[model samples]
Target: MSDAQNTESPASENPLSAWSGRTDGDAPEHLRWHQVVRVAEDAAHNDADRAGTALIGFASDEGVRRNHGRVGASAGPAALRGALSSLALLEGTGALVDAGDVAVRLGDDETPGDLEDGQAELGRHISGLLDEHRLVVVLGGGHETAYASYLGLAGSGRVGPNTRVGILNLDAHFDLREAPLPSSGTPFLQIARDEAAAGRTFSYAVVGVSEANNTRVLFDTARELGVRWMTDETCQTADVTNVRRFVRDFVQDVDVLYLTIDLDVLPASVAPGVSAPAGFGVPYEVIHACVSEATESGKLALADAVELNPGLDVDGRTAKAAARLIHTIVSRHRAG
Candidate 1:
C-alpha cells in the first residue's frame, strides 16, 4: 500500500510511542537506556520545555526504485528503531524525541512526481525542527534523503551566502549521476547545482569513495563541483589521524555541518544489507572515530543514516551497525 493510505504506520500513528522495548531490571537506575526514553507525540511538543536532540525517520524507497537499486529500504526506519530501542544512553538522555517519519505516498492521481513531493515534505519538517534549536538525526530510506536534508538546511533561513554549510557524506559512491530523473545517485549533484543557482558555497566532502564504483564522468563531476573526498584505498586505521586532521580542517571552513552516512560505505561483511555492498569499504572504527571527532567539533548541526535494506540484512547486522553510528553521533552531540 502507498504510504498515504497506510497512515496507520509509525509515520502518522503515535510517532513518539511507536517503538518501545522492555527496560531491563538489571540495568542500573541512572544508567537506564533508550527503552525508557521520553518521547513526544508531535513536533510542537518536542523539546517545548528544553533544547535537545530529536530523532526523525524517513521511510521511502521511490528514489531507490529510480536508481534501480534495492527495494526494501522502506523498512529501514522501523528496523533502526528496534535496534536503538534497547541501547544504553551514555549521556544527554533528557530531551530525545522520536518524531516518527515523513512517509511518502503516491496519490492515485499523482504522477511519479511523488518523489519530489516527499522530499519537499521532508525539507519542511527538518526546517521546522532546526528552527526550534533541535539537533535532528534523520533515519533515512535512501541516499536521496540528502537532497531533502540539504533543502532543510537551506530552507531553515539560518544560513546565508557568507556562512556556508558543510556537508560530510560517508558513502561508497560519489552519487553524482546526471539522470533524467532524481535517484539515489544524484542528490549531491542536485545540491551543488542548487547552491550554484543560489550563489552559495557547496562545501561537500565524501569519505570512503570506491574508485571502482564511480565512473570517470562522476569523478569529473566531483572535480567540477570542487568536492573533497578520500578514497577507500587510503581510509585505513593508520590513516585515521590524518583523516581526523582533514575533517577538522573541513569543519573549520564552514559555519554548520550536516553528516550523512550511507550504510554501503562499510565493508560488505559489516554492512551487507545495502543496495550495493562494498568489497573493501572503510572500517567502522575509522568512520566512527571521524564522525565522533566531527561531532565533537561542535559544528555538527544535523545528521542522518541511510541505505539500510532490512530484507537483505543478515542477522540484523546492518541495522545494529547503523544504530551504533547513530548512537555515537547523538552521544557526542550531547557531549559537545
Candidate 2:
C-alpha cells in the first residue's frame, strides 16, 4: 500500500481535530454533529453491523493543479469538517464516523504525490467503509473526487455489470475534457471509458451547466456519450415542477446513485470559494431540493461535495453552503 493509504490517527496528524460546538445537555435530543462524532480508529472494534454515516476526506488537489485551476482546494476537507462540526444533528441521522483522510503525501522534494495513486487508495478505503456504514460521504479535494467515488462504489460489490448506476453531478461544467492525464476536468470521461471497458452501463446526468463556460466541443462530447444535462439558465428559471420531474426521472432510471456537488454550481455570491465561481448559477433552494429528491429515492449510495477552496472564501460562505447541502443529504437519506 502507498503511504496515502495509511489512514492517519486523530491523535497524530489527522485533520479531524476536536469538533467543538455549543454545549447542550447530555440527552440525545440536544446533540450536535461534533458531540456524536466518533473516530474510526477508536471504533475499529465496534460491531460491523452498526448503522451510521462514514465520512472520509480526500486531501489532494493535484488534479486541480493539472487542470490549471486554483490550488487551495486541497484544504477543502478540513474546512468542510469545521463547518459541519457545529451543525445540529437531527434525529434519525444515526451515527457519524470520522474516517480520517486519504491524503496526497509530499515527497522529500516537496512535490505532491501522484493523483491517480491517491485516488486508488481512496477507492480501497471507501470500499472497505461501505461494508460498515450505510452511507459513505467523501469530502473532496476537487471534482476529481467523482472518479474516486465511482471507484469505491464499483469495488464495493454492491453493484455489478447488470446494475444500472446513476451519477448525478451538480456543477457548472460537464467535466468531460479529453485530457492525456486525469484531472478535475476529466473524471466523468474516465468513468465513461471505464464503464465501457467493463461492459457496465454509464448513466450520468449533470445539472447547473453553464453554456458560456463550456466549449462547443465539450457539448458535442457529452452528446456523443449520451449524457443528460440541464443548463444553468434552465435550472435558474425553471419552475419547481420541471426541476423535480428532471431529477425524479433520472433517479427512477438507475438502481443506485452517486451524487457529486461541485461548489461552483452555486451563484458566486453564495459560493465564491470554488476554483471557478458561477456568474449565473442554480439557486440554493433548487440545489437543496434536488439533493432531497435523490436521497429520498433510497438510491443514493455514495455522495461528495467538492471544490471548496477555503483560501478564496469570504467569511466562510462556501463552506457553510456546502455544509447545509450535506446536512440535507444526511437527514433525508434512506440508507439501503
Candidate 3:
C-alpha cells in the first residue's frame, strides 16, 4: 500500500471536527492531526511546562529499500501518531508534541554530507527541545539520530557522570558496523566510537538478538566493545527485570540514559509490521517492563521507538503495541 493509504484518515465531519474535540472518544488532542513538520520552526517553540515530553518524528531515505515494501518505513512517523492519539494518557499528567520529521535528502549516490547535515538539524532541534529539562523522546526518522541526540545533549554540557545514562537497545541486528563516516544504520556504532575517542565512553546493554541470523562480524564488534547482550536464547526465557538490572549497573556514570527500540527485535508473531522482523523475540511485556524500570530508575533522558511501519501492519496490532509502550513510559515517568 502507498504511504497515503497507511496514514490515518483525515478528521471527519463530526462535532469535534472544527475544534480539537474527542470525536473518537477520550484520546488526547495533541495526538490527533499532528502535522508532519518539514522545517525546524514548528519544532522549536514549545512551553516547557506545557509540554511534558517532546518527541520529534521524522525519517531518512538512507538504508531504505525500494520494492515499495519496508522502504515505506518513511511512513512510520505518521503511522505511529495515528496509534498514539486517544491513548489513555495513563496518569494524565504529561503532554507530548509531534515535532514533525527532520527534513532529509534521499536517493542513491547521496552524499555523506547529507547524513551529517541531517544529524546537524536533529541536534539543533533536540537541543532546543531540551531547554525545559523535559525528557526528549525522538520517535525517529531512522536510528541514525541516536548519534545526534547524544552529541547535542552532550554538547549542551548536561550529559555527565551523575545522570548515569547508558543505552538500552532492542534490535535484531547489532548495527555495530561502522563506515569511514556515518549513515542511517551506523548511528549507535558512531555514537560509541566517537564518544570514546573523545574520552567519553558510553555503555550499551542490548537484548533480543538473533545469533542464528546475525553476521559473525557484528558479534565480534559487540564483543570488542564490551557491550552486554541478551540474544534470542536469553530473551526466550529471561525475565524483563534481568535486562533492566544490566542497564541499572552498566550506566552508573551518567545522569540520564538514551534508550533506542528497533522493532526488528520482536518475533514475526508480534512485531510483524517492522522493516526486519525476526523469528524468536521478546514479548511485548518485555518492552513495557524495560521502559517502566528505566524510567523509574530516574535516568531516562530520551527514549525512541523506531521501525514501526504501520502501512504493512495487520489489524493495527503492532502499532497499538508501540503506542502502549510509549504510554507506559510516560506513566512511569509521571509516577516518579
Q: Report the number of the highest-TM-score candidate.
A: 2
Off by over 4 Å in 3: 1-51, 65-69, 110-113, 160-164, 251-253, 334-336
Misplaced by over 4 Å in model 1 are 1-11, 25-33, 36-50, 106-113, 334-336
Better of 1 and 2 by TM-score: 2
Write model 1 residue lDDT over 147-171, tens digit each, in one string: 9889988888567767678999988
Candidate of highest lDDT: 2
lDDT of each: 0.80, 0.84, 0.62
TM-score for predicted model 1 compared with the true structure: 0.91
Q: If both were scored by TM-score, which would come out higher, candidate 2 or candidate 3?
A: 2
| N/CA/C clash count, model 3 | 13
Summed backbone clashes in each candidate are 0, 0, 13
Which 10 consecutive residues of model 2 have the lowest summed lDDT? Answer: 7-16
